[model samples]
Target: MIAEATEMLLSHLVLFVLVLTRLSTLLMAMPAVGVGVPKRVRALLAITLSVLLLPTISNDLTSSTLPQIDNLIELLVAVAREALVGMLIGTVVQLLITGMQLAGELISSTGGMQLGDALDPTTRANMPALARMIGMLVTTVFIGLGGHRYMLAALMDSFQTMAPGNVILHQGMMDLVLHELSVGMSAGIRLAAPVLTALLLTNLVTGFISRTLPGLNVLAIGLNINAMAMLAVTAMAIGGASWIFSAELDVVFERIARLW
Candidate 1:
């Protein structure tokens, strides 16, 4: 009886580690949860999540051996596969967020704020002030709308459909990713179109005024006018931006679910 209990304990331990590997990888790339979170806190969250998910994962491990390898080579290969799957899941969500940031970049470039770009904490890269604000705004909305919960649920579902040790980079996944890239670009354009249009009109007006009054410094006035127009247009378009971002995020979950 003791030997049987020991064997069961070992099996659970192995399954727990494998589950933890995937969870940790996914959480590392997750927005809001991964980038700024402390290592210790992230580790605790991964462990806690692993334990909670163990019940669902246990059934899949029944046929596999505890070591599941004849040597270290096979073990490393398995680990790489698990990490790849986790990374792929994270990448899908990241692409949607990237689209929102791209819209901000467009707005900033139109408004002349791209020159005033600074390092953004969220992405740890130099980004325009407007772009940073938009990224943060979208991220806040995503978290507030239970995006994290949906991602967790999706991870669980992936295990049931894809199963541990069965993940692969197949053509279907590639097609989905390509489609999403197109969607992201479309979303960025839609979000920035209103502001861009306003800026274009402002430029035309400034050019006409320059032609009418050659003495006036169009360069000096055009920049400020463009900046103001950008602010006004962005404020008016913010509601639509939010709707677009939310809609894209919803699609992210849908595509991820079909990955299996």
Candidate 2:
């Protein structure tokens, strides 16, 4: 009786560790959950989430159809596979979040502001101030809309669909990633289109004034006008930008589901 109980306990412990490998890897790759968060806190969160999800996935471990871990080598392989699956999903979500930063690049380009760089608190990376601000705004919207909740849900569902040690890598996965990246890039351009257009018009008017009044310091005047125009255009177009981000955030989870 004692031997049987010890065997069962070992099996459950092994299963829990396998599940944690994936969850911990995922938390390490995600933005708010990983980038800005302290390592200890992220680890605690991953462990907490793993415990919560263990019951739901426990049946998976007991299934006869599940892959057998015959030795230490097999267990290591399973751990690696699970980590890859989690990181893959996290990368896709990170790509979506970068759309806002791309839009900021577009807006800053016209103002000659993209050249100046600063440290971003969230990512701890150096980027233009406008890009940093937009990234923060998108992060705010992501949290506000419960995007993190949806992200966690999708991650949970992946285990049921993909299963640990069974993630298949195929051409379709690459195609999906490419398609999502294209969508993210297009979203950035669309979000910044209004501001870009306004900046273009501002440049043209400045050029016309410079030509008409050659004695004026056209360079100085144009710089001031571009700054003012960028501010105005940003204020006017923030609503549309938010809508684009929200729409893209919705699509990210759907794509993640299909990828697995």
Candidate 3:
């Protein structure tokens, strides 16, 4: 009887490890949770989530479908597959935030804000102030809109379909990722279009002024006008930007659900 109980406890322990692997990988890739979050805290959250999720994962498994943890090679393969699944989900959701940051980079390049580049604590990289600001704004909006909750729901549902040791890396998943990438790029361009247009017009007017009035300091005046135009257009378009991001985020979540 004691041996049977020991075997049961060992099986549960192995399942917990697998659940933790997937959860930790997913959480580490998430922008809201991973970025600027301490490693120790993330570890604790992963462990806590694993403990909570283990029972559900176990219930979902059948005796025949349980991963062959007794075999070292099979166990490693299962862990690897779980990590891949976690990364796929995380990457898909992260694309939305990347698109917003891309928009900010475009605006900065066109509006002379690139000069204010600084190290962003969240990303731990040098980024234009505008880009960093927009990244932070989108992240805040994501949390506010309960995107993180939706993300977790999607992860949970994925397990209902994609069990450990059964996550197949198929062409469909690759296509989905590529589609998200293209969408992100296009979305960035669309978000920055207004500012880009305003800056273009500002440049044209400044050029015409310089040609007609060679004595005027067109360079200095144009710089100030460009800055003002960028600020003004961005302020007016902020709401629209948020709307677009929110819509795109919804689409992202839907795609994840459909794929998984």
Using TM-score as the measure, which candidate wins?
3
Task: Compose the digit string of candidate 2's lDDT tens values, residues 1-260.
Answer: 99989876766676777779888887887767777888899889989988998777877655553555768998898888788777767767677768668888888876888677898765677778877777777778878898778767877787887766566667866776787788878888898898899889989999999899999999999989999998998888877767888898788788777766
- Runs in model 2 deviating more than 4 A are 1-7, 121-124
Q: Rank the candidates by TM-score, best first.
A: 3, 1, 2
Candidate 3 lDDT, tens digit per residue, 1-260? 99989988877777777778888889988877887689999999999988888888889999766665768887888889888788778887677678777888899988887778999765677888887778788888888899878878988988888876566777878887888888877877888999999999999999999999999999899999999999999898766667778888898888888897
What's the TM-score of every candidate structure? 0.91, 0.91, 0.94
What's the lDDT for all of these models?
A: 0.80, 0.79, 0.83
Q: After superposition, how far is residue 148 of candidate 2 from its true place, in Å?
A: 1.3
> Which scores better on lDDT, 1 or 3?
3
**Residues 1-260, candidate 1, lDDT per residue (tens digit)?**
99989877865665676678889999987888788799999999999989888886776555643445445676577668777778767777777777777888998977888687999775688888777777778888888889889888888887776666555567877777777778877887898999999999999999999999999989999998998999999999877767888998898888888777
Q: Which stretches of candidate 3 lie over 4 Å from their true place?
A: 1-3
Candidate number of the best lDDT:
3
The ten-residue window of minimal lDDT in model 2 covers 60-69
- Candidate 1's C-alpha lDDT? 0.80
lDDT of 3 at 129: 84
